[model samples]
Target chain A: MSVLEIKNISKSFGTLDVIKDISFSVEKGQVVSVIGPSGSGKSTLLRCATMLEKVDSGYIAYGDNIMVSNDAAGRAKYSDKATLNKIKLSTGLIFQNFNLFPHLSVLRNITEAPVCVLKKDKNEARQTALELLDKMGLSDKADSYPCQLSGGQQQRVSIARALALDPEILFFDEPTSALDPELTGEILKVIRTLAEDNMTMVIVTHEMAFARDVSDHVIFMDGGYIVEQGEPNEIINNPSSERMRTFLKRIIEK
Target chain B: MDYSELLKVTGILLQYLLPTLKIFGYTLAFSIPLGMVVAMLKMCRFKPVSWITNIYILIMRGTPLMLQIITIYYAIPMIQTGGSDFFGGLFSGFDTRSDTYQFTALLIAFVLNYAAYFAEIFRGGIEAIAKGQHEAAFTLGFTKTQTFFRIILPQVVKRVLPASSNEVITLVKDTSLANVIAYAEIFRKAKEQMVFYSSLAPLFIAGVFYFVMNAVLTVVFNFIEKKLDYYQ
Candidate 1:
């Protein structure tokens, strides 16, 4: 069963059409990687999927309900607050910058959503947050603030924060882009673990090798559209389009 | 120029010092929260609420504090009564010279003046937070109000404290402005003593009182800044 579906989605900022008629789908428990050159609208596509940016026109369905659709005037209809809240509850997004609340302790950062948004019992939220932290190997830093932790540790905390809500699908927007090479390993390792657990994930990433290693399928985007997509091996080893071959050659040369 | 006379004036000034400090305390207690409300209103996306709050802050910050005190103490009753016989009868026994009236007028003026300044400090702090913070909070399913109180307000308070402390210290000195309305604060009492004695000693004594009060406030605010040192 498809967990998410996007049909003919488009997004424009003022006069610029950042995303033009992008369509994609993710099946249950499948890890899909979106790879593209800089300025290809990969991140914007992810943001639009999560309703962080209003789409110019599209239909996005999560499960059986339509989350976004164009009205009679051809303007995308956003979900109301109640429906948006429900959509957000089921979809978690991890940002590249971590964006942890600096004033909150690590444990509080992880448990905040569960306690506040999910309305879980305090003790239950704490236990779940602790479990997530432990899974990320960050249990010892629970009492520390974001400033006290390394960038890698903070990113792990952000992932734990997202996971605490127990969303069915997670969106990672270049999760390791802001990390140092050594730090990137830690975050990628955590994500690799999630993939092993069959967690449904849609990742917009620059880590080509990690995508090739862990993703069930890979998508190559260029010029605001999908240039090529297939199984990881098929796309990496036997890309059919000359554009894909040139893009892959350029990435490999660098 | 006997030293003992100067000492007597200083002793008299001390008697009124506590009451002045009480006014400062009450003004701060009221204005901090009030300033946050004003800041929120100014930042609100709703045009009418933001416009009204902006006008209020502008008028309060633009006008003279002394005039505001005069208007509250003297002009309010005139406007209410419109110089009618009923007005005279209603307030005939009321005395503006009473301690209650004096303190109330001073308190009102101080709160209004400082609330404007504090509101600006709050706005600056809130604006300092990166746009990414709100985006992150929104993606996490936080409502606008929850995002503000939980994530944004704490960070704003942290950033605003230094500027806020500066305003607070200035407020301690601004309390002297209350003397313009005959509030009998420490400065008022000290000036009265100087008029009778025809000496600079009373003014010097008043200076000491302000210095001492400001010094104490500096220490308290420093302690507060230290508690917020987690970010540093």
Candidate 2:
């Protein structure tokens, strides 16, 4: 089953063509990792798929609900408010900087959306939040604020926050890019656990080795288009394109 | 100054304390919320609305408060002509001819003037929040209103505390400017008593009242800051 389908999507920031007619689909419980150099439109593609940015001309659907599609005039028109909201409720996005609400405690941060947005019972939400925290190994830091926690711990809390909503799909924009090399492993490990639990996810990442190890599929994007994409081992190990060879060589040298 | 004279002076000045604080309390009560409205208006995306708010802020902040108070009290009546039934009916309830009109005029000027300053401070606090906070909240399915009140406002309150305290303290001292309109607040009473007693001691006693009020404010603001320290 296709969890998300983005077809013929193109986006531009003013005159700069950031994403040019990119298309992809994520299957149920499949982890798709998008790997590319800087300014390759990977982030923009993720943003467009997540509805943070609108495509110039394309279609995006979550399950069978179309969130955005073209009109007769060729302008992108979003779904009506109620349907758009339903689509939003079904997906989650985690940022690189771990944009946790600083004024809230770890427990409140996780439970807030569940109680407020989903209208879950207060006790039920708190119980779920406690369980998520325990799973994240942050049970002891429930009362602590984001500023009080280290970067890795904050990212874990953010992941827990996303899970509390029970979204069908989670999108990550460099989940571990902002952390120290030593701290990156913990976030990757958490994502690996989710993958093992058969969670559907689309990740734009720079961790080449982790992509090869954990991702079911790898997408290589450069200059606003997918240069190549296939099974993780096939894409990462056997380079068929000149640009992919140079890109991998540069990273390996670094 | 003799001890008995000191006590007598203190007694007289204390009688005017409530009236002085009335101006401070009322101005604060009205201005804080009005300032929030003004801040939103100033930040409106519509160019004309924000431009008008900008000019209002400019006029309030550029002119002296004393001039504004005097204009509100005196110039309003002078500007109203008998044939202008519209203006006459608008201010008909407010008899600018009455001696008590000074209090109303003083309040109008103080609120408008102080609200502008508070508006600017609030605008700064709102803008200081990082863009990522809004994005994170949006991704979590929070509406714009929910994101502002639930996520942004509490943090804004903490960030604006110190600057707001400074304005509040200034308002305490600015209340003495009411003496210019002969409203007979504490400082004006102290001045009259000084002349009567042939001593400067009454003036110094007036200082005591202001200092004590500001001291209490300092303590309250400090306590609030300490409470917010747990987060930052």
Candidate 3:
């Protein structure tokens, strides 16, 4: 079964339509990269899919559990709270700003949801948290506060926090866009490792080479719709549309 | 300034510390939590709860606490009894026969008045948290209750510490106002000593008591502010 299915999703803020009739699905263990310029609805699409923002009209299903479906009257209807909670427990999202709880130490940030929300044993959660921190190359910084870490380090800790929940699918919304130019490499490398592990994931990003190297399928979005989608080599190296060509040229030239 | 007289004044003033500290302790124990509840009500989306709490806050803040003390201690009892047993019957079962009823009235006055100030401080702290924190907690599958107590309130306490400290020092001094109801806190004892001895030394010694109390609180609050300074 596909890990995620979003059908005919539409969203808007006031009069500005952010996402327009977008549909896509992520098969289990498949890596999909959403590449688009600013205001191309890449982040909005990710937000809607992750339930951060409600869609105006659509059906969203995660692993055969329908999260939201359009009713007979065409209004979005959400499932019961128990089902939604179950769905959320199986998904994780990493934000651009890192959004680490400022007052909590790094170890607490990673172990909090596991111990509190997932009801894992405290010592067991701490043990697993240490493992994830070691994977993120941040084991030494366990007790440090978020503000004490560099932007790159903080973003990596956020990734560990998301992964500590054992999510079935992960979403990254421009994870590296907020980092310094020199600091983006470490985050991209970490994401590459996750892809190597065959994690089912979707990433909205601006790094052309990183997307081409890490994703199984590439999606190019513009004006709230998919402009093109295909294997990474064909779409990244040989674009068929003028808009995709222009957008890719602008990123590749720089 | 006889040495023996000075020591005697200090000794007498120290003995009155219990009632003064009692007022401070009881009011803080009740008002801090009461203020939190009222602040939540004010912030809740219900129009009627917010409106009613607004009126309560406005009335409490708009008037002098001294007036409130007098009204609660004196006027309420009068209104409860003056219209004969028909009206006074409501307060018949009210525990007025105890010697501590007057002190309870004073406590009630302090709690209601100080709770209004604390509610605003708490509301400001609560609203100042960024929206991202709530979103992060929710997406992590935390219930609304867990999100608030675990993720939200610790940050609020950190932010509101300095303002809360100022109010706390003011409360140390505000405890003197309990003398209005003739409850005989430390200040009242000092006033009696002044009249009895025909000297202002008791009053000066009382000033020392207040200064010492305020200074001690300043140090404790500074320590707290430093402790919570681990966050931004």
Candidate 4:
């Protein structure tokens, strides 16, 4: 069964349609990478999928439940807070800016959601947070604040924070876009490990080589629509669309 | 003019200062939570609730606090019980023109006025937080209240501390305005000493007292700011 199904999803800000009739599905343990030029609405699509941006029309389903919709006025609304909470539990989001709570220590940052929101036992949340930090090779940095960590370390802690919630699918929005070239390896390594474990993920990324390497399915988007999609090898090796060819040529050359 | 007279005046001022400090303390004790409630009401998404709080804040902030004191002290009793006799009888036989009445009026006026200003400060602080933090908290499955208290309020307090400390210190000075109601606070005692002794020294001494109190408050606020230095 598909873990997430989005049908005819559309989003617009004022009158400018950022996403139009977008539809896709993710199976239980698939890694899908969305690649496109700037202004292609890839990030907006990811945000809409996560219910961060309300879609103007259509519906998002997780398992058998619809998570969002438009009312008579065409304003997007979630099904309900309770159902949104359940839907959010199944998905984790990794942001490009590494929006860690600066006031909290690394350990607290990871455990805050689990302890406060999930109502997990404090000791158990701390243990899980520490274990996730250890997985990110950041156990020693647990007591440090986000400001004390490098961009790579902070991003890794952000991932650990998401993982501490035990989400089934992770949505990464340009995870490496803000990293220095040298620092990108650490974050990519953690993502690569997750991909190897067959954790369902939908990633909007700019790293062409990383997309070509780790993605099971590659989606090319441009002008607020999916231009092309196929196996990573096919999309990278064969050009089906002239726009895709031009886009890939520019990325590959750069 | 002599040291003995100075001592007598200083001792008299000390007698009133304690009650003044008590009033200030009690007013703050009442106002902080009351202000927070007002701030919450002002921020409520519901239009009528927020609108009512907005008008309350506007009236409290827009009117002179001296008028509020007079209204609370004089007008409220006249309006409620029809005369000072009935109002005085209600207050354990204390006369409405007595020091106790003035003290109560001053306390209410200070609390209401500061509550309005603090509400505005709180509103600015709460609104200053990036919308992303709310989204982050929501996505983490935090309920709206949990997101506010755990994630949002702490950050808001950190941001508002400097401005709040300024207001708090200003509040200390503003307490001097209580003299209008005939409550014998520090400044009132100084004025009374001048009238009785024909000396300006007691007035200057009161300035010293205010300076010392504000200095102490400044130190306390600095310590608090230091504790919140995590963001830096």
Alpha-carbon error at B180 in model 4, in Å?
Answer: 0.8
Candidates in descending DockQ order = 2, 3, 1, 4
Tell me the docking grade of candidate 1: medium
The estimated TM-scores of all candidates read 0.92, 0.97, 0.94, 0.92
In angstroms, the error of model 1 at A41 is 1.2
Which numbered prediction scores highest in DockQ against the true structure? 2
CAPRI accuracy category, model 3: medium
Ranking by lDDT: 2, 3, 1, 4
Q: How much does each candidate deviate from the true structure in C-alpha RMSD?
A: 3.1, 1.5, 2.2, 3.3
Candidate 1 TM-score versus the reference: 0.92
iRMSD, model 2, in Å: 0.8
Model 1 ranges off by over 4 Å: B1-4, B48-52, B71-74, B81-99
Model 2's alpha-carbon lDDT is 0.92
Alpha-carbon shift of residue A110 in model 2 (angstroms): 0.4
Badly placed stretches (over 4 Å) of model 4 are A69-80, B47-52, B81-100
TM-score computed on alpha carbons, candidate 4: 0.92
* Each candidate's interface RMSD: 1.2, 0.8, 0.9, 1.2
TM-score of 2: 0.97
Evaluated with lDDT, which candidate comes out highest? Answer: 2
Candidate 3 local lDDT, residue B100: 87
Model 3, residue A38: what's the lDDT?
94
Candidate 1 residue lDDT tens string, A141-186:
9999999999999999999998988888999999998988999999
Docking verdict class for candidate 4: medium
